[model samples]
Target: MPGRLQHKSALITGAGSGIGLESALLFAAEGAHVLLVDVNLAAAERAARLVAERSPGVQAAAFKADVSKEAEVKAAVDQAVALFGRLDVMFNNAGIMHPADDNALNTEERIWDLTMAVNLKGVWWGCKYAILAMRANPTDAARGLHTGGSIINTASFVAIMGAATPQLAYTASKGAVLAMTRELAMVHAREGIRLNSICPGPLKTPLLMDFLNTEEKRERRLVHLPMGRFGEAIEIAKGALFLASDDSSYMTGTDFKVDGGLTSCYVTPQGEQVLPPPASLI
Candidate 1:
């Protein structure tokens, strides 16, 4: 049987690690020719190797580029079109959260700039170039080489709800991403292209692992999570697959929350006044 993304082509940034890397593998498994783009050249190549191992003869390659840079973003998209003949999906998933982003007062100017540049500006550049490439293809009505494509941006649960631990810059950047996804979706809704953002909760990716390596930090996070666990990278990958495939034909500009019910519960059963038992205590 043909896969969901049979014969499709995709360009995914941050494909070297975490959610982006997992999604690249999943997309390839679904029969999409994936172009893995990342700032880390070696890591991207390693990911490409893993994909090749899983799906022999799979049309998946890695590209090195900084999504925050317009020239790099344009060139990366151009390369994907050049190699694949057409682009069907674009996953803008590259992002970074500062270690020092514990609170608003402690977040330095440099941290804010870096976070905003990569998280917000990078998404904008990816969308701009991806859309341009997709627009070059003939409209879906024509059914030509490029019949438009899907764009998936990565947001976070922090964008939906503020938490006690404040990463002000990260939160602000992601909030902009949510808005941008909606506006862009409207702007290109008639062009046969779909745009959406995925909002993930605390995930068990390498990035998160590095951040929550300590016992105290890990337990602290579980307290607020209704599911009492961190999300898996594969979970986010599944969300990307849905948005990238025609499965969500009518969906665009929507933010799919992959948080472990973190955003769903306003008050815990423990009561608003009473805090849930600590993860260790439980």
Candidate 2:
């Protein structure tokens, strides 16, 4: 049987590590040609190699692009189109949670600006260029391909709920992504383009692990999780896959939360011993 994303092409930002890298692998496994974009060219190249090793015959390449810079983002999108002939999925998954990003008062102007540049403005540029490419996408009747495509932005559960240990800039940037994605989805719905934000909860990714360095810091966030543990990047990648494929063809302008039930609870249940085993690339 053919894969869900058979014959499609996808461009994924921040494909060096974390959710971005995992999603690229999954998308390729599902039969999509993938371009892994990242500011770090070496890491992106490494990820592309992994995709090639894991999914033989699937096309995967690496490009260095800083999503905050419109020119670079446009270049990356153009590269994807050049390599794959059309852009079918754009996953704007590159983002940063700076160590200096704390509460409103403690966070510096530089930190907030940097976070917004990468997290908010980055998603904007990704969507803008991808939409333009998708609009001109050529039909491949024999392969069942057509114009317009899916766009998935990485938001966060913090956008919907308050965090006691506030990364104010990070939270605010994600909230903006949620709003921006919704409006874009509405504007492009008539053109067959679907846009949605994937809100992930606190995860054990290097980004969050660096922030929650101390046991107390980790526990502070963990106590509230109904699952009693942090989430894994692969879990979020699965959610992105659904959004990218025709499986979610009817969905648009939605906050698709794979948040480990974080947004739904005021107080989490206690005394659970067994939990779902974490998924990883290895």
Best by TM-score: 2
47-97 in candidate 2: lDDT tens per residue?
A: 999999999978999999999999999999999999999999999999999
What are the models' TM-scores? 0.91, 0.97
lDDT of 1 by residue, 113-226 (tens): 999999999999999999998988644443333567899999989889875456788889999999999999999999988999999989877776676768888776777777
Candidate 2, residue 80: how far the Cα is off, in Å: 0.2
Worst 10 residues of 2 by lDDT: 273-282
Segments of candidate 2 deviating more than 4 angstroms: 274-282
Per-candidate Cα lDDT values, in order, are: 0.87, 0.95
| Clash pairs (backbone) in predicted model 1 | none
Which ranges of candidate 1 are over 4 A from the true structure?
A: 138-146, 267-282
Cα TM-score of candidate 2: 0.97
Cα-based RMSD of candidate 2: 1.3
